[model samples]
Target: MRNITVEEFRASCAAAQQLEIVERKGMGHPDSICDAVMDNISVRLSEEYLQEFGEILHHNIDKCLLVAGEVTGIFGGGMVTHPMLLVIGDRATFSAEGKDIDVNSIAVDTAGRWFDENLRFVEPEFLDYQVELKPGSAELTDIFRRKEKMLGSNDTSAAVGYAPLSFTEKMVLDTEKYLNSPDFKEKYPESGEDIKVMGVRKDSDLDLTVAMPVVDRFLDSEEHYFRVKEDLTDAINTFIADYVEENKVSMDVTFSLNNLDMPGRGMNGIYTTVTGTSAEDADCGQVGRGNRVNGIIPLNRPVSSEAAAGKNPVSHVGKIYNALSHRIADRIYTAVPDVEEAYVWLLSDIGAPIDRPKVAAAQIIMKKGSVESVQDEVTEVIDRELENIGEFTMELARGMVPLY
Candidate 1:
């Protein structure tokens, strides 16, 4: 202590940290706004209402929650007014009968912040809002009426869980934790380079494949999963732009690999088909099968539509879904490899800007490996399924349901 000097003491002082203002916009659709309002009111009002009446208006209350999910559009809700406030994750504060209540500040099941730095898995666009309760306008009946009009349905039960691996599912489970863990990232880096090798068994009878960009080096689960996925996409796009040459095949490379352990199980027989027309051909032989056929299924599933009046549907599905599934599988392939029994599915719908084409859905299932084979086996199969998205597209362009 006696030997300490001014410069030495100055060096030992802790550095100051800057506060970050994480801003989010509002979902513009009335359905989304209504859902946010209902979810906020649920926990805050449920027990309080139950205490006054033998049972709360549970049915009406439940509808509010469902309507919130149907909203698909969002817009900027100005800036977040309060930057320093800490809004707990699950449990939110709300007003009832002109009185504000903090029901169980320590509610472990619902309250507390979601400790993730990146919340993309929740598709924050669907959840974040700056709602101000209108005077005399917070009644449950009003919300129901508004939702029915905006969502175009009072029966929304059928709309729930129709697909797999939605952003919402990613939030409510431990998958987010596994994705954000450094160990997970270190083991499954986006770039294939610097791969953490897991010894493969020669006797393993599963088609396990991992697809994504390979990094020059490896990093692990220190960051969130969606964040990693986004970063990986950006890096790969940059690589393609810089390294890929013109004319020789400037391929937009997406990785998908398939293997069949139980090749004779008939499970391997499920194939994707695409239907499309050449801008020049009125009648072509490739009606159901796409030109770029991979795996075993080469036959095109004929889908008579504007996009494929004389073209093939199978080939179209193969290219689009194959790419989409590979990318989608890359997201959850590690956590749940055996996707078949895990309820593996992918739902792709169309959106605006028809020329650019967006991935309306890309999802998969994951369960405990003990009940299934290699997690990658299911991952590979899903990738194979996606290779036939064009079949679905042709049907959509023709106003027909492609697949259930």
Candidate 2:
């Protein structure tokens, strides 16, 4: 059988515009018309409206079409406004403006019920939000950008409704959990199945739990794309807000991660104690009396012997260190109060008689919860801990050093 020309079909279509034409196999179909209209709308629709309808399509496409009838009484009937073309076999061919477009047939179930049951358009409320991350904060910005990448991927399904968490943000929490656990493997047996956790050790800062949402796996369709996009956006925003809150504690304090042993005046000798004092044989003649205080010092105090040696105005005064400690304390206090116990450590070179006493140390302070209230106690302790050292101030200080 020879194929009929589109012109002939159009002439026939014009003759029986109202005829309940029996849709023929390999002939133009109604669904094909709808599909074409939908595709055109998707591409030409304003981004604003696209987002709006896209969201609706994500969860309610069926209702959008069919539900309109319930309230308006204007669908599926003689008004000819909401056109319903007949379907035959698995193909629906229709002629429009002398051109033929074929659409794959929808199933009876989909055509009769599901297709139009979910696309009801309703008056909706719109909400607006502005991101609050600092503009120049690279880490926060990077995290945000990463989220955008994940959300904007071609996977429309994940892009549509899925959201993901940042690897960096999640790492911090995972590190905390792992460090606090007595037997991480036992506590988290599934660790064996995690390819990322192979060699993790105790007290390590490495965050083995970092993961980004794999939106690629589900981006096969428009519906999934919308779903993933919503989810990814929400996840990123939530994580950022929490991170910012935790780090806000150290806003005013600064800490140094570098060596802190040099006096402003000159290089002091090794921080060794000498029994003999100045020309006068004073009671300070203890043999083991080395000026260099060798061990750890409280992070709240100056740790360099040079500080005490030159009485260098700021020597051993704990100005910077105390400021840092207080900042941490402030954050923790604000976030979590009533910490029953806290531990802090500092390393120092107390004095300088010997050639060199390197001043380097880490603070390891722990505090017990002081309050009887459960939520209050947990929050208070966390706040205090965050205030003390959670902010990246120590990291920020290196870049701000004066150019010598």
Candidate 3:
């Protein structure tokens, strides 16, 4: 049995009449890069530990930082003055018996491989000169060592998730995915992976602000950059138009890319980077600064501040519960037609069983006068989802779920 609470609420994300804003930091954003690298490090550690010890060890490499690099570039060429600095930090059990796990090597190699696969403008050699690793503090490591088993949570934290994404939320998230998809890349080879999509919904008007990096190798001049931007804008607009028509939603949609522009400086004033990410010249990055577990940053929606990336899949409630909350909310919303919006909040105590959280709460805003009739059904869904929380670890380990 689970300690679960279900309640009906009048206010919900979908019922908000005011303007709503949603944001997505694409895969190549510096903060996203940090999140990806940390998650990869965790996965690599889990794999190696499983191979050696027959079970994953206790570790969490969620803390990381990416220091921006200095670079100068033009339309056709650029030079890097300083390489980006990556510092991977967190607690881990790397030593057992007479054997010591080379954690630094794992971290560096994972980051390099991620960059090679995701970043088009930056070479892997840049990471060879830039990345560093700092082990977790002795006190934190001691705390982890005190855990009774490998699957117990080592920290107390709360994770929040909501389901049935609003129209703008889905649009914003899918736009980023579409732009970064392999099909889009094939058509726009000069487009870099570092992309940010911001969607604003004001009644029937939808406004999108997109920031994308242009690879210098593929762009010969400022005109070429503008042309590519126009092409991208056209493609995105077509997609949005088709979506609106297909979904039977009425909205006036508009797009503006890279709003930082000067009067005299045209393309130069826009969002351009040598490495296809602002980390090359303007912005630094840190883990947990990017997307939430559900992907979109919905400013108007309730969200948890807990960072999910790189936490242990086995028992870290911060990671498991965040993903689980989303799953629960999604399930409830789908199973109960009366539920217009569902918000799930989970609280976990350190050293407690992973499946049985301290509190599992679900708040729902149902269709008018339908809450009383469907309360039992909604409660049943929540109870069923809570019962299956233990399966989240295997799903996460198998890469069936994404933390960001």
Candidate 4:
């Protein structure tokens, strides 16, 4: 029997609460880089496997690490003293039916392609890659050879997803995206992609502090750096102000960029980078240290601890449950009436059918109705999603679903 539960949430949701905090690590951040690169490698491997073999094989390439390289630069110029090191590893099916797949080439090629597409200044040559993906163990590889089309859940794990993002949450997510947008970059090429945004909301007001590094090549002098900083700050503030007013997004939203800069400290005070990311010199990165499946990190709400990126889309509970929980939560919030917010939790048992979770639970914060009133509708939504979980897994295998 499938375990399912629904209950009324007595306390206020994050949106209703007066104080809320949310965070987002932009794509160029070291941790995000690792997540993106590893996830890309997994997707490529899945595609290759499906093409060569008739089925998507067993694999999980979630492990990845970034070691910071050395770099030094002055205004108008900088050079990488040493290239960044990217170590990617995990498990995969290297050989099947006496045929071998080149996992190493796929990983390195995928990682290189991801860098070219995402980070403007960081080239493939600027980083060295070490792929440590080995074949899965005998017991684990046997799971994929089952007679049934549906794979069993490979791990016991729990994931939570909430719907109806609060205004503060929206601001934090969208602002980082805006900073990384192509138009923003064209207007201010000095802006780096290694940006992080933190939002603290009190009641109806929000204060957003953004840390976006500057490209050393674009900066000519200390004065020029300050000017660029001021220009970028004013531009972002203006955009946010207009965005809130035009879209009716939120109240009293404020934006500040690079608050750590000091006037005369030379390179010490400024947040400038040879490349657009800190992975070139200052900080390292790893998988799962970036965003959740929903993108923003909403501190007030329960979230998935699993890093969805790079895990096998078929049977890995960490990746599947984490992504599905959000879809279920969103569906509930949209389908049910008078529901202020919906949170969906899915727990998986190892060796259980992937379609049937160990526990499918929903905790509802009502807007105008009691949990009893919406109970049947919420339960129906969860049941429907769980039944259709295989389709979701297919979508994941096709790279149609966004995991990061």
Best by TM-score: 4
Q: Write the per-residue lDDT of candidate 4 for residues 199-229, one digit (tens) a residue.
A: 9998988899999999999987888899988
Please give me the total number of clashing residue pairs in predicted model 4. 0
**Whole-model Cα lDDT of every candidate shown, in order:** 0.25, 0.22, 0.79, 0.88
Question: Is 1 or 2 the stronger prediction by lDDT?
Answer: 1
After the best TM-score superposition of candidate 4, give how far the Cα of residue 25 lies from its true spot, in angstroms.
0.2
lDDT of 2 by residue, 1-404 (tens): 11111100112111112221111100011122222222222222112222333210110011011111111111111121222222212111122225432222222223333223321111111101111111122332232233231111111110000001122223333332332243632442212111111111122121122222111222333344344434533543454456546744321211111022233321121110010001011111111111111111112222232211111011122212322333333343334433322222222233321111122112222234223333444334333432333122222122121100
Task: State model 1's lDDT.
Answer: 0.25
Q: Which stretches of candidate 1 lie over 4 Å from their true place?
A: 1-112, 115-129, 135-178, 181-404
Candidate 3: segments with Cα more than 4 A from true spot: 128-150
Pick the lDDT winner: 4
Using all chains and alpha carbons, the TM-scores for the candidates as numbered come to 0.22, 0.14, 0.92, 0.98
Q: Count backbone clashes in candidate 3.
A: 0
Q: Which model, 3 or 4, shows the larger TM-score? A: 4
Alpha-carbon deviation at 22 in model 2, angstroms: 67
TM-score of 4: 0.98
User: Candidates ranked by lDDT, best first?
Assistant: 4, 3, 1, 2
lDDT of 3 by residue, 1-404 (tens): 77888887657456266699899999889899888889988888888877777666677888888888888886677878888888888766677556688888888888888888888778764553343445555654454455454345667888888988888888899889998999999998777788999998888788999988777767776676777778877888898888888778777878887677543475466556777888887888899999998888889887888888887777677888889899989999888886788888989887677667888888888776666687788778878876676576868765568876
Candidate 4, which segments miss by more than 4 Å at Cα?
Answer: none
